[model samples]
Target: RSLAESLDAELLMYLAQRRITPGFLNEIDLFLRGHPELAEYTPDFVRRFNNARPLAAYRFFLKGYTRPARYVPGILPERDDQITLPHELPSVASTVDDELVDFFDGYEYRYDILRRIDDQVRALCNFLRSGGRLTWTQRLLVGLTLFGNPVDAYKHYEYNYQTEWLPHRYLPEHVVLSEVPKEPDYSVPTARVRTLDGADDKTRHTFLNTRRKMARANDAGV
Candidate 1:
């Protein structure tokens, strides 16, 4: 039972990531609440079970109620119009140091900071409508990091249809039938041509005549 409950919670987490509706969350919540023995194994349910609002409880579960890190004033570099003296320095003869600095600064100054902030904001607004928290640009960047792009993700999953559902036995009978192609009948009658070889001319001619007569008789049901 403990293992089953743990598995159920894991599945619920996957569904939450897919952004299932509040009603579905409520149903799961009710199910957990009804099964007190199983509820003990699902800490997420216990944490949010007492909340008056089902949606709030669901969001808390989805986001893990994670508190964002306190904003540190100087921890993040200030983005300003003023260029620093080091940035203005001419490239050295080796060029390696300057290239390394540029690469480090590009990731440190932009990608890393933005990624952290994006994660925090996503956690904070776990319940926000589709377009609420992250802007299109932020979504594109994060999506690229995670799944490359929607088109690639779609194509990848579409090519491996089995990944989207449970195994064959668990699927509905009709759904399984719809997906599977009917097997061809290999026993159906087909025309055959026979060659009479390694025989004298008369024997070969006699065999050919006999074959023709048998074919005609069979066709006429005689």
Candidate 2:
């Protein structure tokens, strides 16, 4: 709820500054309310934003920049711009590597893009802490994720979807390391009977005989 409210407030601010339109604000609000994808990681954002390293927090934008980040906005095209992902992406083949590939997959650009706004929030928090002044654009950005930093915030989604969804969907179930089995092989029985409810006289007698022998052996200190 706090996150939704913060985003709405940011949208309003952006709308006021001409950085975003009322239509853009409405669409963003709808996106936040309707989409479960972004919500899943909001808790982490709130948590990490509070304890982020002061210097690391400042450098996180740069420190985590493996390549120029691509930006995408949801609100206004004029507000849209691409910053190279901080690092060079690895090649995509039989496998995808985070070290090489832009983990965000070019989804960051927008009029009020989730990623860009997220960055705005972190930069604002850092700026305020340092007594730095914000321009209209910067103020609008900071509100997007007032309690979160972009580097730590968006990565949760990338990691979650990549780890939780990709292996199960695109690759074989065995390839995915999940808390529970992604899909079960129907050819195998889900359950097995290791013991029988009833036994024949021969089996019962044999069991009793073995128990008796063991008891006698123990008694004799064998």
Cα shift from native, residue 160, model 1 (Å): 16
What would the per-residue lDDT of candidate 2 be over residues 2-25, giving only the tens digit for each residue?
Answer: 222444454355334433334433
Candidate 2 deviant stretches above 4 angstroms: 2-14, 46-222
lDDT of each: 0.34, 0.34
The TM-score measured for candidate 1 stands at 0.19
lDDT of 1 by residue, 23-82 (tens): 444444444445564334554545554542443443333322111111123322232211
lDDT (C-alpha) at residue 44 in model 2: 50
Q: What TM-score against the true fold does each predicted structure earn?
A: 0.19, 0.19
Q: What are the clash counts of all predictions, listed in order? A: 0, 31
